[model samples]
Target: MDIENMRAFITVAEHQSISHAAKELHQLQSNMTAKIKKIESEFNKELFYRKPRGMELNEEGKKLYAQFKKIVLLWEETRSMMNEDSPVLRLGLMVSKNPPNFDDAMKALYETYENLMVTIKTGSTPKIEEELVNGTIDIGFLVGKTDMNSLHYKKYGTEKLVLVGKNIDKPLEEILKHDNLIISSENCYYKKILDVLLEDHKAIRSDFVEIAALESMMNMCQLGMGVTLIPESDTARLGIRHYKVIDHSCCEIEKFISYRKNHKITGVEQQLMNRIVTAN
Candidate 1:
């Protein structure tokens, strides 16, 4: 079957509307309809049931959709691996949460493979997960637990979460009454964790000052602008004092280096992965 036709079919199946899929693919509706018809004819099966509002997949279409999605993922992986002229390794790192030595990993990758090109994107874990699923990034450095079974991960280690501020001697309740809660936006995974912690302590955040960069967050905390939560290990590196959160029962978060399971690991890719996973 033609890959383009299969792609159209997948798009139609996902949207359940030929017009919507056509718009997404930037193709005419008539062309999209013809492609779906050609695929159904080739398979000798009725893939979708025509409806007044939209198309709905039958059992046959559901089976084909599942198989074809895998085929598309595999094709993308193969093409990426074979691009030797510009061996770009795309990486997504969660900057809001402290990860283990991602800069060191990139440095090692560049040193080991001089010709390789590296592209790095920073965001929260969910953003990284989205990019990994769509094959936009080859690797992700994330903190916290992910239930995405399609991606395989190597755990770096678990670290304790602590509240850091310039005045480390302040009482926990006094610290909670402060105006500033320096952290990422509402959708951040770490933000969600902090929300639960705050609720358990019966503390209400007076203000949330959004900061994307970890270094900036630390700097803000040091200047006494606001206090932020960070890993205990990072506090030592930054020469700042960190106190354990009130509820010590659930304060640990896991760090990981993750990639799609379908992608084949090249020698250079393997080396990069090793550096990511083995590095402290």
Candidate 2:
């Protein structure tokens, strides 16, 4: 039996609705309906009784669902246990949270797969997207709008952006008139928001500096060089002053884990994905 079709059968049976099952599986309703139909044709049996409410499994479907559940469990266990040196998982990270918080997930991964190699690169969203398309990276974490139809993404969390400064004794209005701004590279999404905010405030700067690294940006702000926008969670321990944006729409960013839609997900990849999605 086709494993995907069997899996689809199980999902539909559990949900008792093809539309719900299709949404959960990230597949179109028509595609999911076709898969179920194909499975029924293969077995030469009607697995579900069509109804106005939804699909209800017939006797044969109940029997096959029970067996398929065990089969899926066994296959997952086997795949998890098959340990060997796997290809490198090239990951791209865009945000910087100090005291690196992914230790537990990394430890769990190493324990589960002893020989798999992992590499991490940090860059802007556009830069990482280019790398992903060129096969230089396998997966990436991005913040902001993701409109690439050729890629797949799961939104895991949200980060709040705030204007952070060091030892500023002046009001926000006075600070806006300083004409000095610190931010990331030109391609950064945060930088774009900062530009819009500056324009709205009529505080166009002739002294805006582009610092590529998050640590460096914070350091520059600490030295009273200029104010910068940073993720709110990252400013807790830095003893910095952060202000909520006057326009609240640009302050919240949706965090996503993105990968190529056509790439096959392996057991290891799925485990790592689960850990990341859960941890965040």
Candidate 3:
């Protein structure tokens, strides 16, 4: 089967209209329709349901679409590798209070491959994992654990959690009792650890505030609006004053580097991974 035909099929499946796909691909609508028909004739299967609304993929088309996406990705990667002129790396990073030395790794990669193009996407661990599984990203750096069997993970390191507030002279219990606890989100990993710490100290806050941005969180903490639990490294970098290190084992969370299990790691990827591991 022609790669171009497969690409056309994928495009039509995505857009649900040959005309729209043709416009996006810069091809004539008739040419796009012919390509789709050619694919259907070759497979001897009706891949789409053509209604007045648009063309929708049937079950057979859905299955083939998934496989074709992987094939196209592999083909592109192989072609780039063969060229030996330029390579692209897509990275998915989870939001972290204390991130890994990914900058150093990226710098090393750039030095080694002058023409390398790097793309980065930042999100939650689940989002990163989803992108990795869908082949949208080449690698991911995330906190917490993953149960995805389609990907492989390696322990990068651990981040120490710390409690930061404006007033450190007061007792831990008094601080918790008087101030609100600021958190990035309800699902934040730090919130979970804070809950555990509260239970251990038998402390309860008057209220809690949710702020999404890290800089905003820091500013809130600085203003004495509330106390928050964050990575120790972040506290130092942000020049946060009055923070107590949480010594409990649970305070240190393991970080991991994740990638698709079947992904072909090129020399560039391997070099980047090596630098990251070594730095950690």
Candidate 4:
């Protein structure tokens, strides 16, 4: 019934190896074994079966895992809602991709709570999460489920990202002969996706721009200087249009907010988060 047992169970399910799970959970193998056993005993069900090679979930274990996952999510939500301060909420926003929604969210969050001191940190996920762990920032808007240990996640919205270019069409063969290719620096996650898209199409990237600022990239796109690809929703804010890669779609980055699973914040951050979401 304890959170420790569920934690151990989830880790083991992820790796399917007791030793690996123990390492991941930062506990000794024997200790994790004991915790798992205690939980199984309490529930009166077999959680995992030791095969000749490795551990596999039994029918009961699978059912338990499914239920436990939902339980943990709800438990964390309830815990967060219960603990909050009205004074201030330190927020970190990593710009994995610029958005039509994110800017609106930022503005609404800042304006809605007049008394709350909200410090906005803007950078890549790696940059923001470093601050999150170092106690400089309380929450981070990052991409996907990273291996930041014990971070609780809440998903917001998804914007479809595509490879884009100016005066470009669906058939890429005719377009490849042109000399211009747009790229932001490696700091942006969108840049990484663009690199792969270029390589896949056998397109030579003769032009490149390394703009670290999200606003700067949009400015560049609007000038008709060169073509750039960005999140579809994001492009509307800028003065340019975008086209999707019907032939080649490589990746979709998930946007999520992360905070320490143990550190609960209800009215402090959630109030602003809700305001921004409602405004959008």
Candidate 5:
């Protein structure tokens, strides 16, 4: 079967509409329909149940979809290995104060392999997990452990969670009661820990601020606009002294490095992973 046909089958199965899949693939609806028909003809089986609403995959179609996805991924990986002189390592990272030391790792990788190329995508843990399963990234650095069976996880390091504010002299209860809660994002793991700490203290903040940039959040906290919870490494790096170490039950969080379980680890990729694991 053609690799393009396999990709088209996966897209149609995901969208359940040839028109939608065609638009996504920048192809005509007729072309998409013909590709599906060709696949079904080759298999001598009706893969889809044509409903008025949309095309739904049959049992055989579901099986083929799974296999085709793997085949497409393998084809891409093989092509990448054959076509490029330099090896490329795609990485996904969760936004955090103290992420893995990829800067040093990449520096070492580039020094060892002159033609090594590295790409990084940063987002929430869930986003990173999704991209990893989709085979967009080879490795992921994220907060906490993941229960994804398709991926394998390793303990990268641990971070000491701390609350940073201008008024470190004040009591925790007073700070929680009066100060605004400044967080990076709604899905941030540190924000969840802060939520639990607040519940434990039964303290309600006056307001909350969501800032995407770490520097901005820290500046806001320095100006007494709000208080934010971050890794103690961040405060030390920035030379911020007006912060208190969180003594709550969730004071520390583990960082993890994840990758797809079935992914074939290349020599360069393995070297980078070794450097990261050793450094951490």
Candidate 6:
């Protein structure tokens, strides 16, 4: 079936006026009328009964309209979703509070391929991970290790997790008595570490406050909103001093590029992934 002709029929059916449909579609009145006739001739059926005030669906028209409406809507939705899957590769990045080296990796990936659309979404681990799992994002650079079986990851490197706060803080024990720990949402990997700390120390869950991203959390911490646990790289960038955990339980974590393992990799997506891995 001619999708365009059906589209015109559907619109005319909806508006009940060829003139109205033409106006809405930015088409000429005669053009709209001709398209409707084209559909009718093809089906050997007249879809609409013309009247002075407007048009109404005939019996044959009503049945065909019901069937075609579902098909057209589905086609439109499919097209819309496919629009997100343009031949251009889509990439999602989860940059820490610090400068990310993944930009270099992207530059490397695009150097050899003209068909690439790199989209960077910078946020805390939880936000980025959600995008990767939901398939909203094609690729992601996340902080910390993940156990998701469907997704595979290659740990590029580790960034030291430092204790960040304003002035003082000779040792962690002196501060652990405090009531709050500012961190990312629960979905975040780093936040998981904090949860462990809170559990071990018997810290109140009510004292935890999750921020949107590293920058916001760090800024809030800087303004004395609350103390935050962040990567050592963030400490320098936020212009704040940091200290190491005294207990020797390592706070450093591995960063990784993660994607669905079972997903059928398109040729272009595969090539792009290869380029990303090679560049990294």
RMSD of each: 12.4, 7.4, 14.8, 7.5, 13.4, 19.2
Query: Which residue segments of model 3 deviate by more than 4 Å?
Result: 1-85, 96-99, 201-207
Span of ten consecutive residues with least summed lDDT in model 5: 270-279
- Tens-digit lDDT string for candidate 1 (1-280): 8777877998788678999888656699999999999988888999898999999999999999878866765554455456555667788877754356557756755664467787778888888888898999888878875669788775667777788767656776676676377887666776777677677779887467888777888888887787777777776777875554645655788877788878765545644654444455
Taking all chains together, each candidate's TM-score versus the true structure is 0.62, 0.69, 0.63, 0.56, 0.66, 0.55
Off by over 4 Å in 2: 1-26, 30-80, 83-87, 95-101, 167-173, 237-247
For 150-250, candidate 2 gives per-residue lDDT tens digits of: 67766667888887766455765677677367767777778777767767777765566888777787787877788877777776666664554444677
Clash pairs, candidate 2, are none
Model 5 agreement with the true structure over 136-202: per-residue lDDT tens digits: 8998888875579898776657888888878767888877777888887887777778778888889
lDDT of 1 at 51: 96
TM-score-sorted candidate list, best first: 2, 5, 3, 1, 4, 6
What's the residue-level lDDT of 150 in candidate 4?
63
Q: What is the overall TM-score of model 2 with all chains considered together?
A: 0.69
Q: By the TM-score metric, which is better: model 3 or model 6?
A: 3
Q: Tell me the lDDT of model 6 at 262.
A: 55
Question: Tens digits of per-residue lDDT for model 6 on 1-280?
Answer: 8877776887687668898778655699999989988888988988788898999999999888777766665564345345535445555655454236445645654564455565566665666666777787766667775567667665545777776666326445445557357767656666677666666766656567877667787777666666766776665556775555435354767777677665554545544443343343
Candidate 5 has an lDDT of 0.78
lDDT of 4 at 196: 70
Question: In model 4, what are the clashing residue pairs, if there are any?
Answer: none
Total backbone collisions, model 1: 0
Residue ranges of candidate 5 with Cα displaced over 4 Å? 1-84, 96-100, 204-207
TM-score of candidate 6 against the unseen true structure: 0.55
Using alpha carbons, what is the TM-score of model 4?
0.56
- Which 10 successive residues of model 2 have the least lDDT summed? 95-104
Error of 4 at 162 (Å): 3.2
Model 1 CA deviation exceeding 4 Å by range: 1-86, 96-101, 177-179, 242-247
Least lDDT summed over 10 consecutive residues: which range in candidate 3? 93-102
Give the per-residue lDDT of model 3 (tens digit) for 1-280.
9988988998788778898788656699999999999989999999999989889999999998878866765565455567657677888876644245677667756765678988888777777898999989998877775569988776668888778877756776777667788887776667777777778889865366888798888888888777888777776678875787756887888888788878876656655664565466
lDDT of 6 at 272: 44
